[model samples]
Target: MAVLSLKKSNLPSVWLFSFQVIFLALFVGLKFQTGYDWPIYEAHYAAIQRGESFYLDFEFGYEWIVQVASRVGLAFEQFSAVVSVLEVAFIAIAVRHFFPRYCLVVMAVMYSVPDFYLIPTFSLLRQGLAVSIFLIGVCKVFSGKKISGLVYFTIACSLHYSVIGGVFLLGLVYIFPLSRMTFSLIFAAAVVLYVASFDIIRGVVEVLIVYVDPKYMIYLDRDVFNASFAYRAAFAVVSLVIFTCIYSAWMRRESSDGDHFDRGFGLLSYRLALLGVLIPLIIFGFPTLSTRYQYFFAIFVIGCSLGALQYVNYASRIMVVAVIAVTAYLPFYRFLSSPLSIVYIPYQSQLFYDQTNSTGHDRTNDLLNQLDVLWSK
Candidate 1:
């Protein structure tokens, strides 16, 4: 896609981007006893404080962070705040590096996608940190720093094993470039396979269980796969993948070949975005795996979408932005209507809200009531 021409001295854009980075860091960092996984994280923190051994399921890097925080006498809230800041900082670094002129717009597109921003930032702490680091590594790799990129990728995988899939995908795309037509064929085949291979996939997982960590079996739980929310989420991801595919194709055709960096990086983004489409379709039966793994590529998909924006006129750009905005909002609306919405509905800051209070208890009860209603349906 054509690059947006913004003045280098656009002070207002820079300032606005700065404010967003600061606000996001503070907002997510200071959140108190909210988010889906806060209770689990809090329990882990408490275990560390009691001098208990680290949970085997958690990555070594994450355990090290918890251990360091516990030894330094930092509370769970404070530790979380630090991690949150690092996450936001890494994300900002990547955004500014790759899309300096349209950093704000690119960031807006990222934040609009809940899986790319909200869920990762607020709930999936370890994977989120790893993804953020991996994003910077992607920037380095695209800039021709292979050794540095490998180092970053290693560190990212150390934080979350889930990053291995992403790293593998990146390496595959980098080493063996595929045409857009090949990607389309693969995407179509994946959809067909997903429609017909549920039992086959289940059998494969069962066979691998003996060799894999027992903890990962939760990803195959029937309850998770059968949940109404899972279907809704899968639908949203598939829609996003299709949208990204279309725009990325437009970007490749409309963009000029004069800028080597833009052309090369844009092509990489396009290929990765196509992989993002295939991920969901290939793993449709494994919702958790599909959702968690897709985000790694979704980052590139967002880049493709934003890059495509440059090829369009103002009216079409506005229309594309509107579509992106609505795509972002639908997931949030679905979450609000779900039983677990109570976990995040009213944002609570550690500075002002007491999680142990009756208000918190009421929210918990409300959540239970909603779950009962859902299950009884």
Candidate 2:
């Protein structure tokens, strides 16, 4: 009987390991991808190899990796390929505590996750690395490794200053031990604030910009309700489900022995996730500068969702999984049916580039003509 129990537990772990390995292989096998920022990152890495003074455009931590690759006599392409795999490894470590099956399911379905399969995934190089580290750090903090988590957070900041926003959110988690009622009241105030005049909201955004680089002023714009009502309604529905999962967690702590789940971290991460998701929807009318916070927000939600699952009764488990699955599906469906049929029409990759380049075909024109088809009758 003991051996049988062990076998059951080990089966999921083995499957989880296989899932991680497959993801690493798929991402690393790519020699090139067509994210909009690929050319920019390609140029930046070349400048580093040439020993040009190019640190102003990128952070030192990112440049440091390119420099090491240069010294090791590897091309920027090879280095970037390997580093992409490493970032995924970091995320795996970050969510190691979650039931591997659930984590794999989420990763497979959730395109919003920066590293998940998508063109946008490749667009963020430095920021993606920073987010990977910060996620692991938050998980570590939740697991009671405060010092280790702080070290990871510091490393994240070194990679990209934007991670400061994540750090600030974590700090708030520690400062304010929150409750469901607190979140409720806060959301109420946010709606009130949302109804206020644009001048007032713009002033709030202005105050926020002061905390970051003034150069970001270039990205800030007045928020617009550009999406259909259905899209907006989806956001509200998802938010409510997340709030319910989190609030139910508080109830679980009060009723159960608390050994089956790690509510402390679940609560901390959920509070951060809630605020992260809420502020962007409530206050920042447009997801310009504030949009980056969504990645950080998503990580903690994964943490909370998985952590809560470990403890909830069978019936509660049904609701939690259902909520997570539906909430994740919304953004993913939007991605596939969007203009991607234009940008990623042929889903070109390094393999295509190699084959076509060998034949002396103009790859740029090929991509353009593919996109042109979507526009033409």
C-alpha lDDT of residue 345 in model 1: 67
Model 1 worst lDDT window (10 residues): 1-10
TM-score of each: 0.82, 0.77
lDDT tens digits, residue span 247-283, model 1: 5644565455636634555567677777776776676
Write one digit per residue (lDDT tens) for candidate 2, span 51-73: 88664567778777778888898
RMSD for each of the candidates: 4.3, 5.8
Residue pairs clashing in model 2 are none
TM-score of 1: 0.82
